[model samples]
Target: MVFSWRKRKPRNGDKKVHHMELEIPRHFICPIALDLMKDPVTISSGMTYDRESIEKWLEEGNFTCPVTNQVLTNFDQIPNHSLRKMIQDWCVENRSHGVERIPTPRIPVSSAEVSEVLFSVTDSKRRLDRCECLNSVHKIKKWGLESERNRRCIVANDAAGVLAAAFDAFASDSVEKNANVLEEILYVMNWMFPLAEAQLLLGSKPSLRCMVWFLKSNDISVKQNSINVLKELTSCDQLYGERLAAIDGVIGILFKFIKDPISPLITKASLMVIYHMVSSPNEKTKAELVEMGLVSLLLESIIESEKSYCERALGVIDKLCETKQGRESAYDNALAMPVLVKKILRVSELATEYSVLAIWKLSKYEEKVLIEALQVGAFQKLLLLIQVGCSGETKEKATELLKLLNPYRPGLECIDSQDFKNIKRSF
Candidate 1:
């Protein structure tokens, strides 16, 4: 029992008339299915089709009216109840033809309904009633993941700000038993990615304390969420300053994320945050990272991580080695010298610069380390690095390291990168 139109009335000023037979109308066939639309739904463009058919069309990258060539603002699909009833009646009338009725559609959570739920947070009497607020926010978060429309609804209705306030409320009081409330808030914000205001609020001191508290939470998901959000917060230029990064125990937690990251994402964030921390010429911060075994950790991690992580690790290492203590610690690590040399010309251009700089820093004052560098074929790597070609700055650093090593070894033979045809022997 499908249906379709065969003709329509002509436009005004035209006296033309058309007639068609309606013995068994073909108005029931869906354009997408060429048959009856079971579980039909109407889109924003006023088009109706089978729910699964239209969903598939949308999912396959179509985002316009299938018939009218109009663009759709959103993908909210509303169940066509009136059309379903008509199809059901037609199916009953055509029972002999084997047509069947489509099942009842489930009710969707509307934007207005979600707003009603979110608005409960503002109730003065229920202001202290956290469960109601938590439950409402949890519903909003759940609906947000259900579809794009729900996500837009959540954002448009300021669900992130409400959740941030709820989070801050619980975090401010910090009742030991109410950690679940914080965990729920963390989960929601992680999903939301929290807009500018919400992100700023979350980066505030009180909220940061709660986040760091969550890092110590027994729940692994909460810990990861806390790390991810911190990553997000520090990435913003405004939030990376004195309020959060300078907070006591922040670097320790970031180091902990590095020492024992639950996942690769944590490791990446830890590196990024630590780099950001050290980039501001904070000697105390760099020294703290070094004392926390940052040098050893990065040397190990560089091997474990892929290209981008390795590059960032080197960048941080270079920054840290500017301090004398950082250099000593790196020299103490058994893998430091070998790893630093191995990375040159092998890992990346940036890594090459870092490796050479580390060599200069470590070997400049430690002749024993210089002898070890020569024995490990460090001079060969630096010379090759300059020959194979790198950034002008990288070449200059490599050349400087080579010259420093030459005076010490005296007999180390190397060729000029710009004049490889002529062999220059250092005597």
Candidate 2:
């Protein structure tokens, strides 16, 4: 491969023969992979290699050179531009042989550039061309995903507020005509979210209300992105959280997402946001969620969800079970106690902890609930759970329930069946 970027002049080109040739030199190949370097880089050991190959070596904890076996003090893989140029030119010359020239890779956006975009995006009154401003912010968002440094740059410069402003601009202009722009803002928000937040600020409540309308957007990605923004704001941005939750139909809309989630992540975010809102410990909020029928939805999620989803589902279930209405909802359902019992040892430790706690609550709040649980064969599962051994907290909860049931031995015997044999010996 030719490493020279200088094109051969016609003075030397005049002597070229009719035949064409493609030749790659040994030094042009990476010693590590023995292949032509795509992005050649030199390590501190003075050994050059393909950037991908050398990075993998360093990541795997190899501090010595692959070729020289010399100790690498810095292990910095500096890009070999000259080698890249040579490879690019060689491919250009070998175009007839099906070799394709690699395009130049973009350098990551710098902190200064991010700062400029933040200033421009936030400076709403500027007479500057609007499209150019949006395009610059878009590039910064793209760069934020490029590298950790770029992400820090964008976050440190207040990407959240920038995105909110962009959202407000396009949304105010014309939602249908400018929806493409709104989607871009959502994408940027999704990337910048769960980032540096002390400097970041959500938009005004009016603009935030506008964001709520996005929940109905037909695009699944847009819906997920909107939920992501709401989740972050509600969890970290206290001012925005309360306002977002106060919007009409917020709980019902989110419940729809939970019931018919576009993706597991959306479902998880919906559950987490609900969990945060319910954590206000407000009697009204808890009652509202219970009134919205979250208990049955959470139960369905538990039965169908995977391990992580099950953990989150049970988490919400545990929270909802704190209210009288929540318990009544759970107890009223025939599947409630039986399904909660099934997850005791079937899912994760977190799930088991919540499941046991829910049962404990039912038993503690009302003795009839405990007897009902026993009548449903909960004692059999509890018996197996304690004997099999689990976390101390789960074991403690189970032990309490068993002690509660020990006095009801005759009731337990009446409840036991051949499917769960030796119920008498369990205690």
Candidate 3:
């Protein structure tokens, strides 16, 4: 007997009908796993998509629901691939106590929708005016409400909308209004919002005040966010003497994370921040960083960390030993030279070349140090680098350093003409 197959239809007044109607939209689907886009991919099709791309999108909260166009703004919406194991362990611990999963409130808007709304405000002047008006309203309502009243008021005004506007203002090319709006947003976010939201908004500006505030916070999320902001700020010209000067104790705080046993990204970011801080223009800051035992930390990291961290730490050391004060700091601390030399001898060929250049620079100030470096086969390393025609700067510096080391040595006759010819060739 043949059986007739039919798809089940929802009956009227059925509870399951409501659940079916609330199905996730196709556009909200995550391309990677074909799920309900748990972690929304934020990049436009034009840009390169890599692990870093997904990470940045997650950081900026760019994922949206396909149907509602609302932002999936919660941290949970994005998979914390790095912390998954930790979270699983926590869940297991709670399960042992018979605790059940608790539901979290969904964010009503997405970052993309907010950007779209801001862009809809056509005239730039009018857009700025409207944003300012909205900001003032937010501030006034914030001050007026107490307890849950404030929260309800904020929700009523649409916190996500206001935040999106604030971000637009911060990214505006008009420096005057951008800086002001950024500062105000930071104040509100840090003092009022929950830690996650505050951390999300930390990317608005990388000012000195913001950096210090993030550093001083007891919140680990805030501290991590601050490390990112500091890295960005230091890379820009806005890194002034005053700001660089304040980074003296920053390295110490970062070092605390070395033993954290979780979040290698945090440790990596901390090292990057230290690298930038030490490489800044302010001598006192650089000197203080070295004095704070940065060399030892970097040395330890070199042996312990993987290639990327080791390379970055070595770059930091190179910068540290570039200047007179940095050189003296290394010399005063006896352990610096030996560790540096050892790294030079052991790492990749590129690292060896950098080490040779660093040693050449050190030789300029202290001949004895140069002799010690030479005894570690510095000359042989430099010769190999010169033969391979590594960096032009490295070659020239080595040539000059060789002249200074032994002008009357046997192979010195052709060095001056070769140096001149290389300079001419470059020109």
Candidate 4:
């Protein structure tokens, strides 16, 4: 067969060389991607592919080799150094024809290297050398961002714990003084979540108090990340929530987040933090949330929230309505009835449950709520929710609500019903 090469004149003491045409050798193409392999690697199936292509396939939860259709015996990707060298050489030879040489890929980080980095950070912190700790943290953050493998290794090496110690140490003593170090730690720790151990470490009084200070930061990223880390810390531990809530102005700051949202993520996270705080909450805590206008905020958020957030906002409302002051605050809001009625069967099952439960709670104190529910088509939606599916508690709540509104069912024509599709369309 004829070759797809064009002869080139010899240079001074240089041998004759050939330049490639548009056609690339079939063997140079990755089996999976059907393109030139930038970083060719061989797998257990003896098949070679570009590293990214194979990684994408495996990341999609695939267990078999794409081309060979054989189950992967080993996940290790052994680099095809010989083939890569040849490809690099070919690219160099064909440079005049617009071919570019692929640079060598860096080696993946090893466990020992991560251990060294971890030691440097801990050693710096142990020595009370802020400058050394800052430098080491920056270096580890760079290493973590280099590759997925490096990130996994860093995580496996308890980087979150290392960062959390440094974080809590500074936060406990003087976070404001070393604001850059604290922010950098948060920036790195944001990606290393399930931070169970880190949260436990940060659950101390001083650390939690420092987080409140960070929440009031002028910088939005600092504020957002501070809340994000706080959310994680308060996720499962009610004691932490109680301590955080007791930190004067913590509740007010959360209210500010909802009243003037920094971002959608911050808003949702704030709601979640409130949700956890309310779990097993004392009478005093519930009253504090209500007095701070949490009921009206929850209603406004439910009205404005998408489906994903509506459930959380409603859940917080449901929790608040458990207390006397919470029910009173919810009743004071004009949108309370209309908004709660509108959510029944209109959002997810959880949203519907919360709406129904809130209605039941509000109607116990005020009889006008039942009449308002009937007028706003809550009766029809309650009928539909019972017909369709919902939790047993939600079903029981809907049943109870139906009995409460049974006295006003005669004016079906006046029931201002808006379907889910219509409400979603408006959004």
Worst 10 residues of 3 by lDDT: 418-427
Off by over 4 Å in 1: 1-40, 44-67, 70-77, 80-110, 122-126, 145-149, 175-178, 238-242, 260-264, 304-312, 345-410, 413-427
Q: After superposition, how far is residue 243 of candidate 1 from its true place, in Å?
A: 3.5
Maximum-lDDT candidate: 4
Clashes of each: 8, 3, 4, 0
Give a tens-digit lDDT track for model 1, residues 1-427. Answer: 4232433455575666554432333555667876677677888988887777887788789989787868999998888888888878876886544445566654556668867877776551135566766676677667766666456657777778877776767667663655766777777777676456787667777788877777777777777888778777767754454455677788888888778877777778778777767767567888888998989989998875787788879888988888998988987888887788777766567777877877777877777777777766788777776776778877887788777778666664433243233233221
Ranking by TM-score: 4, 2, 1, 3
Using TM-score, give the best candidate's number.
4
Q: lDDT value for candidate 4?
A: 0.82
Q: After superposition, how far is residue 394 of candidate 4 from its true place, in Å?
A: 1.6
TM-score for predicted model 3 compared with the true structure? 0.48
RMSD to truth, every model: 12.5, 9.8, 15.6, 7.8
Segments of candidate 4 deviating more than 4 angstroms: 1-26, 29-38, 42-47, 52-78, 81-104, 411-413, 420-427
Candidate 1 colliding pairs, count: 8
Give the per-residue lDDT digits (tens) of candidate 2, residues 159-243.
7766666666656665666566567777777766564442133445555665677778787888888788777766774556566
- Clash pairs for candidate 4: none
TM-score of each prediction = 0.67, 0.71, 0.48, 0.81
In Å, residue 12's CA in model 3 sits off its true spot by 49
